[model samples]
Target: MIEKYEDLNESYVTAGAGKDSTSIFYWGGYGTDQTGITNYDKVDGSDIRGYLKPESGSYNGTPNLSANITAWTNGALSDWNGKANSNVLKGVTTGDGPYTSYATIGHVLNTFLASADAKGYDDWYIPSCAQLALIFMNLTSVNNALSAIGGQQLSPSKAYWVSSEFDSNNGHRVYFKDGSVNGSSKGSRYSVRFIRDI
Candidate 1:
């Protein structure tokens, strides 16, 4: 798991994603900048689990970290801020599908976490590969917590992307179908699942 900022390396040249070319958040200067790279990692006491709401209801207060969560999948909404229709991928009811073709895999997951309003909190962000692994390791507990929502898979039918890459041509992905992990091409359209840190 991305245990700390150092996991990103002193000067990470982003792993190749695909021919499309996507932006990655990095903390270094280009060759002639003359200044050392700046650290971009930030840590605060804010926890995402605090905002995860238990169910849909009249949400009128700030997030409560200690609030009991009833389900995780219930956060899906239609037309986030009315900018589009169907907020969650699985819940999309409009044209094409839940997402437009332009939506990058990373962006979809990030949006899910960022738009979370559970228990009145909205501080969720996408989980890294390591984080997803942690949840996988605690499969029993995680599954139990998410069981209230039927769609969560203890075993995914296909491999899912993690926003982490191994090289210019390879990226890491996890398969819930049988709890297997592997790497594949970035251009390949694979399933994606988003997670947030507790």
Candidate 2:
């Protein structure tokens, strides 16, 4: 039977299709708000911070190696203040986004990555611009599969950070709105989403 996950933050499916059978991926709230100051709800006592891909099946699309680059960077603006800007935070829709400072954003990112210690794996990454694109490309297929299983769709409009650094800059971010990359200031507060190998 299809599976579903319900939490204080959001609800989504936990499975998908594989090369020859069906698979499911449950949403792990890696990078959850711990302090409760960000106006976002905390689902579990331990902030969830990473995604866990279920076993692959026949419907699961094959992985693409070409877009999986290790290093990418987004450009920065002079106005960066290490705080999340309203335009980037997806969880909160008001006040230039959800962070009070850049440090908070970093804490959130680190929290998610660190809380994942219980999972016993450490290849988790913030994802590069190209990698984010791969997600966008596969979003439809994934979405379709999720729909069949009663999963919700996740579409965040903010620019998310990736481990990839830009050739011209020290950091990079992927603007999901247009599938573009930029060299951003490390101090600037942007959104973060984690990825791990299945």
Whole-model lDDT per candidate: 0.32, 0.34
Task: Flag regions of model 2 displaced more than 4 Å.
Answer: 1-100, 104-109, 116-120, 144-152, 167-170
| lDDT tens digits by residue: candidate 1, 1-198 | 111221122111122132122322211111211111111111012321122122223222334322221222122110011111112212321112222323344344333334321223343333434444444445555666556553344443555554443333444454544444444444455544444334
Question: Which stretches of candidate 1 lie above 4 Å from their native place?
Answer: 1-102, 113-122, 149-151
Clashes of 1: 10
- RMSD each, Å: 17.2, 15.7
Distance from true location, Cα of 39 in model 2, Å: 35
Error of 2 at 158 (Å): 2.1
What is candidate 2's lDDT per residue for 21-52, written digit by digit as tens? 11111111123331222221111112211121
Worst 10 residues of 2 by lDDT: 8-17
> How big is the positional error of residue 101 in model 1, measured in Å on the Cα after superposition?
4.6
